[model samples]
Target: MGKIIISTNVSLDGVVQDPDGQEGFRLGGWFGQFGGKDLEAWAKISLEEAMGTEALLLGRRSDEWFAERWQSRSGEWADRLNSLPKYVVSSNLEQPRWSNSTPLTGDVVNEVSKLKQELDGDIVVYASYQLGRTLIEHDLVDELRLVVFPVVLGAGERLFGETSDKKPLRLVHARTIGDGLAFLTYQPVRDA
Candidate 1:
């Protein structure tokens, strides 16, 4: 089976919203707000990861947002993203604007589980907070790659909100980016 990976940018306090200041959250944009050589290196690594992903999983909001933006862009990364098959988890979105996009049309957990069994490549989920929470609750996430920034936002969307259970994670890899950001990779430990 293919792995379902969540790649998210979070703050020291676990906030994961509007890190780029494009989401209208005035208190956000903490990512490049304090820039350094390390930030550049971190960005490069993130881009590399995104490029390597074969398939993309996104929530309805993220799907619409990225579809509107990335579809119109002209670049190597944009080209790859546009060409990759995108699986969007949505209850309300009937049709997606992007090419090669499909909506998860059944029960969220069951449908995603079936998708996992059918897919043959890496499935990367990016910035889909609600879907991420649901996947985490359902024990569907295989790996979590979190790029933790040093800033601590007092209030915002968090990586882990109200969870159904205490999900145990084992740190498999960790590294500090050039700008003091910590790149942490974790895998969920199977319960005995």
Candidate 2:
């Protein structure tokens, strides 16, 4: 069975919006400030993660964003991303234009639940805040991988929203990915 993993790049204050400045959010592109060894570390980690990912699960906005940027690029990273089976949660996108993409528009939780049981590797969720929150709320996320940056965007959307349930996470690993960056992995502690 594949594990549902939520991988996010967040600010010190938990802001996960607009790391590349594509979104019109005022605090967009906050993560672009890193350079030098930090950039190299980020790239290395991303490549490692991609190698282990079986498929990509994205929200509509992220699906569009990734397709627009990656479709025109060619490299090992881009090749891996373009070739992966991508699934998006969107009611409006009847047929996704992205290559090897599928739309999951009905009963997201149920659909993803089935996906988790059927697949053999990892289903990684990248920058899908709405979808991530829903998964978190329902306790469907098996692992949370956070690349925490140094800066803090006080006004942007956060990783965790207002949830009534108390989700306890056990830190499996923590290390410095680069200067002013921390890579942390947490496994959800489910009630048995």
Best by lDDT: 2
lDDT of 2 by residue, 1-192 (tens): 989999989999999988888788888877777433687888899998998999999999889888888888889898998999998988778987667999998898998998888888899999899999999998889999999988867888898998877889999999998777899999999973
State which candidate has the highest TM-score: 2
Over 1-192, each residue of candidate 1 has an lDDT whose tens digit, in order, gives: 778999988888989888778889978778788545677798688679878887889898888778778888877777888898989988777897777899987788998898889987779998898899999999999999998888878899998878876899999999988848899999998782
TM-score of 1: 0.93
Q: lDDT score, residue 65, model 1? A: 75
- Residue-level error in angstroms, candidate 2, position 192: 7.7
Segments of candidate 2 deviating more than 4 angstroms: none
> What is the Å distance of residue 145 in model 1 from its true position?
0.3
